[model samples]
Target chain A: MMEVSPTLPAWVAIVTSILVLLGAALTLIGTIGLVRLNNFYSRVHPPTLGTTLGIGCVLLASMLYFSVVKQRLVVHEVLIAIFVTITTPVTLMLLVSAALRRDWAIGDPSVPVPPGLPEEAERPEPLPESDQPTS
Target chain B: MSVLTRRVLPYPLLSAFLLIMWLLLNQSLSAGHLILGSIIGVAGGLAISSLQIPSGQVRNLHLLVQFAFIVLYDIIRSNIAVTRIVLTPGRVAKSGFLYVKLDIRNEYALAILACVVTSTPGTVWVNFDSAKGELLLHVLDLVDEDEWTDLIKNRYERLLKEIFE
Candidate 1:
């Protein structure tokens, strides 16, 4: 495997190493939290650290290393950062909404059903007789 | 600008952003790249203009910058806080759901606030009720309910109101 040359400036190497280490360590903590946290709701909070700052630090390191090596700005890493920043919330929102829907369906007391609707009424109505017969 | 061009390029800011993004992605500032990026940006902007999105005006640019720095600082601080929470074994942080009543009525601003809150490590925006202007947030380390409410209102929502309302 190719390695970063030892001849590079000390600051560049130090910054890159620090960023990479911090990012990796944060990501590890996030994954561990996923397992250690007692419930799904609480578990949702930790992985976001990995997604937000974990990837952010790694991207920063890559940008700095490549820019120093090539002697030109390497900011395309920003595109990924921007994309992740926008999309992660979207996916998280969808996942949380789906989880909420499931919990509501199962009549989980902790999960609040939307106001003015009973738990059973919130569930999808059964298919028509013809559709049900086919299934 | 002509009426036709104004209609086509309804989102001039978006077009400019796309053009800059294209140049950055290509990593080139040559004339050829500039021309191509401009064309693509204008086309993309025109395409999106068909969607008829309601434009939200940003009232204060200085406040927006301050808001960005505040978010950055909060993100770093929360990253450390959450990392500690995760590392310390068998220590259960007092996590709970809290409902916050928001004064900001602009949808675009509310969406941005949600993204910022959810992206921060310790808080997740679980659900928002538009009817009541209330947001449900799941906080990992819920020490004081009033503290969370005050933080959200004063730190973020106030800045967002200045920016988007």
Candidate 2:
């Protein structure tokens, strides 16, 4: 069994472990912000931490580990990095825009009425202050 | 010869990008993979005609690399900053939406800026009113609105304008 698997150097293993743990800790903290933050807009901020640096660290560690194991540069992680960086923003933008539309339709005061569609913003009579998302 | 190939490969950069992507995904540099990647590149580049993707002319490739480094550094710094914001004992980070007018009109530049803003830890891209050229940014650690506006306009906008417009 030992012969089948290539032996990893102590330093590489240590660095990879540290990077993996750090990435995990960052992602966990980011998600914690999602649950912990009082407002939805604020909640959106934390998860991005997970998507950006969290995946970044983990991919870097994996690239290093596999590159060492293969005795060559293993950089397929670049693809994942590109995809994540591009897609996260696209998805986040869509989600935020959709949420904003819904809030505006419902006359949620927490979100400022959008400037682009003044008609839609004016259409909904402002809701009572009795209910608001956690600010 | 140049004109003929240009007709076949209308988007040379896209072709190269697709080829590189194929090579990276397969993790190989063999002859078979090279030929296959070329095929994919050609097909993909031609296929893009089906979609109406307005191509923006890139001005300075060198500045693009430098801009990428700046973004990377910012991302790392913001990661630490956000970590602090989340881990701090009792106080919640002061978060709010901010509105700033932009001068960049190129759609490609706008898209890139949006990605950068949203990907950064503390700031999220909420909305952009193209008609008004206004950006609605949700900042987690909202302190001074002017500071954020300057950061976007000067740090990113100046460089992006150089690159895209």
Candidate 3:
């Protein structure tokens, strides 16, 4: 933990501490859910709680603390917000798609055959992404 | 000069966004930094233009802003809901896949919806068969499939249609 600035207002300090603690707690919960969840697909949803709100709370705390201390707006946290929101989807989508492919190959019962593909034929190889919907 | 300017700043919107992002990241507004940031911004826009990347337009800024607020509120709300599910004692969270058929065809709107849905706590977008306008999602809690469909279609998709399409 960084040293609390002596000049920082008591209220700002208190609020910052609360936000930091909250961000940490929420992130811990997310990781806990990650361990507790049963399968890959369901596991995907829990960590997002940390990514969306956990990161958000910490960034807000940083922004607020810096703005109060420096007496100028410090909003670099928005960059994280923007980048995280942009990249998380691509990363998660690709991971799930890959997992789905492996699950299909292994004949995982919980995983449904990807829609619009032939139901009878088991696809071991990756299908091209642009395949038109059969239905 | 105009030709040079056009070459330097091939995409004004992208350049402006880059410049703002640079300033925010650096947390500086000094003249030297400003000049350097502007140069980088212009260079970025020029570099991207050479790639001939496609872009999308926002038809309504007001609605976009409104939609942003709605997403913020939902993220917070869902965060709480998901937190409770995780913390409750002996509560089994039944999860399942949800299929949503979307009508909004604009690529930008679809991209935004993807981000919104994925980042929300309880829902993770798995796949979107764009050719069929069908989206498959994995949800943390399986409460009501229709309710989720209605939430996505009406809450975000409708406004996204207005904003992008």
Candidate 4:
């Protein structure tokens, strides 16, 4: 058995423990929110809470631990953070858009597309007017 | 040269990110690492150029910095609050989804917001309606739907609009 160093900074261990616990707790809350929300759109908020801050804390703890132990700036974990930050919204957006399209196509009462907003907003803008005029 | 620059090194920020990631993962700053990383980054950028992802230009540096700091602080606070709820067990409020009407039309901005929401511990980004501009999110804590909407709109969306839109 490897001997544990008593000289290890107490704050690091303490902070790590707290962050892990926090991450776990936030995950639970997100799950709870999923169960409690009244509607499909309403239910979507909580899970994000867990995924964002939960993962953020856990990553922070990992970064802190590795950096302290290795005595180097170990930030490779930021890649995960960045990737998560970029992808989660995209997945959610796609899913939401799909759901909305389904609702609109079916003329579902619960989901209503606002009257003022144009469908064109949903798609990328057309090529510049200058280029089109030339054609 | 034009072809290489236009396709391969189209997005400077993205290439820079790739290079940084390569260096970080490899944990080296040697000449070999820099050269290899730069090659990969430029190549990767070229590969992505065809996808035609709408290029977003960020204008406000101050707002972005503020946004980052705010998110950091919120994460810390939420972590504490959420951990307490999880440990308590029996007292958890029922969870459910919220439909939020959004004023934000920018795909890139909305995407960033979704990531922010999903990565947080107590929330999940379930779906969004592009045509309707509605965001469907699942919450672990179902205390108030309006509150969540307000939080997203005020806390994150506002800054995103300022920075990206």
Best candidate, DockQ: 2
B1-165 in candidate 1: lDDT tens per residue? 799878777788888889998988999999999999999889998898778788767788898888888998999999999999999878988887889999988988888898999899989888888777888888999999999899999989988988987
User: Model 3, B13-68: lDDT tens per residue?
Assistant: 88999989888889889998899889989989989998986677788999888998
User: What's the residue-level lDDT of A65 in candidate 4?
Assistant: 81
**Two-chain complex of model 1, DockQ on C-alpha atoms against the true structure:** 0.58
Q: Which stretches of candidate 4 lie over 4 Å from their true place?
A: A5-62, A84-135, B1-8
lDDT of 2 by residue, A34-110 (tens): 88888777888889888998999999999998899899999999999999998998898888878777677777766
Residue pairs that clash (backbone atoms under 3 angstroms), model 3: none
Q: What digit string (tens of lDDT, one per residue) describes model 4 on residues A35-131? A: 7544555445556666677787899888988788888888988888888777766676566656655545444445545334464445334444443
Q: Write model 2 residue lDDT over B30-141, tens digit each, in one string.
A: 9999999999888887888568577678999999999999999999999899888888889778888899899999998998899999999899898888877989998999
**Better-scoring candidate (lDDT), 1 or 3:** 1
> What ranking emerges by TM-score with the best candidate at the front?
2, 1, 3, 4
Name the better of 1 and 2 by DockQ: 2
> Judged by lDDT relative to the true structure, which candidate is superior, 1 or 2?
2
Q: What tens digits encode model 4's per-residue C-alpha lDDT throughout B29-116? A: 9999999999989988878888987787778989888887887787666656555554464664456567888888888788678767
For candidate 3, give the docking quality class from DockQ: medium
lDDT of 1 by residue, A1-135 (tens): 968777689999999999999999999999999988887778888999888889999999999999989989999999899899999888887787777766665545576654445435756554444433220
Model 4's CAPRI class is acceptable
